[model samples]
Target: MNLRIFGWSYAVTAASLVVALLYGGWEALILCAVLGILEVSLSFDNAVVNATVLERMSEFWQKIFLTIGILIAVFGMRLVFPLLIVGITADLNPVEAVTLALERRPEDDPTSYAYLLNEAYPQIAAFGGMFLLMLFLDWVFTEREHTWLSWVERPLARIGQLNRISVVIAIVALVLLATFLADEPTVVLIAGSLGLITYLAVNGLGDFFEQAGQKQLEAFEEEDAAGPRNGSGPSQLAKATGKAGFFLFLYLEVLDAAFSFDGVIGAFAITTDPIIIALGLGLIGAMFVRSLTVFLVRKGTLADYVYLEHGAHWAIGALAAILLVGIGYHVNEVVTGLVGVAFILSALASSILRNRRLAAQGVETRKTADELAADHTSV
Candidate 1:
């Protein structure tokens, strides 16, 4: 793992910490630091999943993801998103919302920006929860070559063979949530439905383009085997490009937005100051995910650690459940972080075991990863 990719992230983290200390006091700095740590625990799974999608993208789009994606994560989701939400929920215009966000601190007043954002938490939770749920459910249903927790995963995959199974389960979950858990059931229904629709549209198109990209690669590989054409080869055609790359990029952004919902809302629990939230949750968190994504792609972490993706998707499923449940009840950030980390660490441990098992069995395909997994042990 080259540390070079994180150069920009470190620069941003240091710059933000300096800004936090200068802008507020030690209190703000402390809160900012805490949020940064929390965001890593909260979003580490996000980096894993992002790497899975990102590896399918072309180099050009991958560059765009690291550059433009960070800007959107910081400025768009972390900053403007809160302001925009406050504006819509509070019935304040854009300027008024910005003024209120900047001027007012977190007070006991019902009119404060934080108060308004908290009030609208359910809608945000509903939308983001359903979107992430769809992502998790889609993976859950798909029959895969590899799996973790095979006892549970194997059963789910068997049942998932039913057509439209994931969608059915998701809709049923929505109906139950709206019926039993919501204060305003209609709002939950609409928001949740929109989330489901967005997932279908985005994920569906991304898969379509991915298949197309695969076909293109196959064709290029065939041409290369026969004779070289232009300067293209398997390496050049390896990634998804054109429309395929575009949709993959879009899917990643939406996925990041969904992941940030809980973090954004939870940050208010730490500090009502938008600037601190932006600096901590937005800047630092974005840096971690971005750098991790690049690292995973470069190092082939997913291939080496077979169960990491499974662990990440499981964490995502758990998070989706937490968000939906949070609609009516308080969900602790500690619980959320612990759940994600547990899955990730457990999956990592399982991957090591599986690598050893395969190595002991003398599986030819497992040669490379097994070597990386346990270098001391002879094959």
Candidate 2:
């Protein structure tokens, strides 16, 4: 319980509540709190995934994520994004739509926006399903090498520079969906395309930065070998570190947005009040995520549970698939939770069994050594 982190989180949560209350009064406050809690609990896996990215970032960037990044997540996605969705789906002007969301009478049915968004399920399903499929492919391909299924990925690997091609194909598919499939598809298309493209673009940028980082490391090492080693100049070191941190932060934010997609949509299942949704899901939920990140970092949870990262990645993949299913099929939030829990449990059990076997082998080795010593003594 680092008081500083706790204090900051408390302050932010209170501030958000106060703002919501000022705008919408007591009902809004209550809804925001509920949404926040729901968002936090549902997003437990989000913190784990974020930690993977956060750990790689510099301290300054990590602070920025906790500070600035949280605001973007809370306001931009949780608050604005849904209203934007409503505006598109209902053919209303964006400002008018937002005003409607903000000023709708308390007694008025809150499900109006939810109903509109629900109508666009097909597009959501297509985007989410394809995204999940890509994740599964990456996982299966990556793990095959570890499990002696290297043969499977070999052919795929031969299609050199596939990522760029994949991006082009995804763009094409989105165009077709927007052109033909959607009723009022532009908004959905724009949102989905932006999400996908951002993922690809950020990943590409990170890879580029990584390569640049390696080059810099090599140059420094060579320089060191040639002369009496001088400590790295502060400015040069800072630049390199800043570049790495920025890349990592960007990567983390993209992943965070992906994790929040389902949670944001699912919040609709609970309530259509944007302010309540933001307060409940964004402020409370995101604070908990930040806290969870700190907890994981402090406990070194990722290092302890070797397969937990695998489980999280798998969970994310499943969620992505579920999102796609929303296009033509209805998906329950409970089903999403159960499926993720099942995969995680299976992965955890496997890890435990593997560790147990190793422990048993160690015990057998010790017993054998003891027996050999007894025999030598008798001799």
Index of the highest-lDDT prediction: 1
Candidate 2, 254-314: lDDT as tens digits: 6666667677778777677776787777777888788878777666665555555566667
Tens digits of lDDT, candidate 1, 132-216? 9988887887666776888888899799789998889999999898889999999999999999998999888877767777787
Task: Tell me how many residue pairs clash in candidate 1.
Answer: 0
Look at candidate 2 and tell me the lDDT of residue 326: 58
Candidate 2 Cα errors over 4 Å, as ranges: 1-34, 88-94, 105-111, 120-136, 143-194, 228-237, 360-379
State the local distance difference test value for candidate 2. Answer: 0.64
Clashes of each: 0, 10
Q: For model 2, how many clashes?
A: 10
Instruction: Give each model a TM-score.
Output: 0.90, 0.74
